[model samples]
Target: MKKINRREVLKKGVTLGIATTGLTGLMRGRAQPKKLRIGFIALTDCAPAVMAQELGLFKKYGLEVEVAKEASWATTRDHLLSGEITAAHCLFGMPFSVYTGIGGPAGRVLPIAMVFNNNGQAITLSSQDFGGKVGFKDLEGAGKAILAKKKEGKPLTFAMTFPGGTHDLWLRYWLGACGVSPASDVRVIVIPPPQMVANMSVGNMDGFCVGEPWNGVAVKQGIGFTTVASQDIWKHHPEKALVFNNEFFRANPEESQALTKAILEACKWLDNVANRRTAARVIGQRQYVNADPDVIDARLQGVYELGGGLGRRNYTDDYMLFHRGGQTNFPRKSHAIWFLAQYRRWGMLKEKPDYEKIAEAILAQDFYASVAKELKIPLPKDDMQPLGGFIDGVTFDPKDPEGSIKKYKVREL
Candidate 1:
């Protein structure tokens, strides 16, 4: 995709004939919404959807965006499939799961339009059980202890927001790295992100993997301590994305590109660290994340005061990036391949599916590229990268996805 020069438009100063820029054409073709609804869950990463509506970016792009606060990931998936919501702030893996029939029926194709944010999620472990004994640094020991605890009659349970979602993969990988099988050594359950802390408080789950500020909230409530930040597992990892129903994506290219542009603008605004305090306060209202703005902002700014006597650490370098100069929004095919390989590794797939073909279908590169071209944002030179940056000293080569899967000794397949 050719990266247009915004400076040329600026250099022209809206002169008569020179004013018809690509962005102007994008702005001219306004999308008419009969009932365009967008859904979001209550997590810090939902800021993109919130900001897009609040900051008038959707309006700026001539789109009508109705924001729906979904009860859970499953609800979001249902709305997307039924066409109740046109788009959503959704788990990057949910669409893949649904498409591959991992946790739900197939046929609904939810394509990822733009990634919302990355690296603000974490795994919270019960303080009474895993506070100091098992932390991020001692995962090898944590694996052994978790297995030992499970062997004491009652099987220890771990919770994630959705089946075959990013949180599930992270939790399973952490457990596997610690030399424990998520399926055999312990019980893994699906719970919504907002309910993670409450369930833990009632001793329903020994640990959970979820997005902030729940992890921060759990620490403050003295219920659990953050064992590890998701970024610690994989730095700047893609978490959530703007997902739209397949029909909406393929049928209405103009509307889709307009929506993507609006979201891209919102993402740019969100990355401006200076606006986050206010952003947190806005999204923290009763209709949104519904947590204290202070708690949300703390993690939003990469400050962590881990409870259970665990010290605080700052992760500004890798914490919750919404737009890394458009890199964050550019969905990578390699990331999708990794997630697919993970599904295969865990036996979520009966047999290996066409990983690249599915990834290509899921990532709406056309819409994203059009918006990037309109916005003059440069695309990444390469689609695949040597995805490393893991807590385990391992790297996933996108070229050889099967090899990457086999490298894991604790996998089901």
Candidate 2:
């Protein structure tokens, strides 16, 4: 792991020659707001927003920021929509789900300001079922065992954070890849991230897919083991993103850009291996993730215990990354289209959606590009890219989402 100097990083960000060129001019003659309210859930991926508040990055950008730790993703969505908070550390699929009115009535479409982190979530299985036989490769046997249980009139249940969130998608994809039907073989339920371990301890479900710390906590408590880290399902997959209300973004472009820049710098600082320990400690405080720092730190450093005496292994490349070579932060339309494709594949949407149009509306690419250029962050040349391969050997083309949907053998559609 390479060491990082926080002071030097901050100096570079603050001293960027073009930092104040075009965007800052929008703030001229406008009264600077006293404070910006942001929301976050208790998860490891919320590091960027929490770190920005703790490390004074938000203040450094001449913004007084208030960070609110919310109880659930639903609360985060409601607050973001009702103007209680201007932006939030949001699930990647949340903005689109709300826009399309899948789980409920349609609200104002939200836009992703930037992607906060990627590739640290996991799918955990209860120890009681597999008897130490939990791994992605064993999903077929697991499905058989689940079928046997169902034959006795007890269906296996699995949980994810939200209906259309990344956790839900990962769990479904993994189950489908394993030749198990997510819709038929098991009962999929919704459980909050922080409550996942507790619920599993009470034997509420057979397994769950959620963000880190909880998965580590389950392993520590002797209740479950990780069947697969999400990265194994899809390496460098997009996870939580910094999302804002579209109306708020349009109404306050300058403030939005400033906030985005602050988070981008905070993300860069977080990627430094040297800062991870302290980052874990700060994020572990009561108002943030509120978990044991050691548990959070373990996964943050790419160290996995896997519980039940599975021993320890280090995974350097596939851990949670806030800013990895500046590739993680860009809000790519391709990623949005992929989510839309999943929604269509899983029958979350009634009919095929205008993939490009909805992606353009919900992902503020122009604003993100402007901020990236201002911060000297290198941008990807094109908006559309292949799904980049999956554990099931299925690749999706963003250009033909319907074709991607057709490739899924176990889709609801």
If scored against the real structure, what TM-score would every candidate get?
0.93, 0.92
Local accuracy by lDDT, each model: 0.84, 0.82
Residue 333 displacement (Å), model 2? 1.3
**Count of backbone clashes, every candidate in sequence:** 0, 0
For every candidate in turn, the CA RMSD to the true structure comes to 6.3, 4.0
Off by over 4 Å in 1: 1-23, 33-35
Model 1 agreement with the true structure over 20-117: per-residue lDDT tens digits: 12567764776775447889999988988887777666776677878899999999898888888999999988888998888678755789998998
lDDT tens digits, residues 1-413, model 2? 12223464455353321134334543553337568899998999898888777666676666898989888888888888888999999999898888788744575688898899889999888988765565544667666777777788888899999888899999989888777777777899999899999999899999999999999999888889887889888998899999997778989887888889888877887887777787777788876788899999999999988865467767888899988767898888888999888888877887988888888888988889888887778887656878774878888899988998888767888
Clashing residue pairs found in predicted model 2: none
The residue pairs in collision within model 1 are none
Q: Evaluated with lDDT, which candidate comes out highest? A: 1
The candidate that wins on TM-score is 1
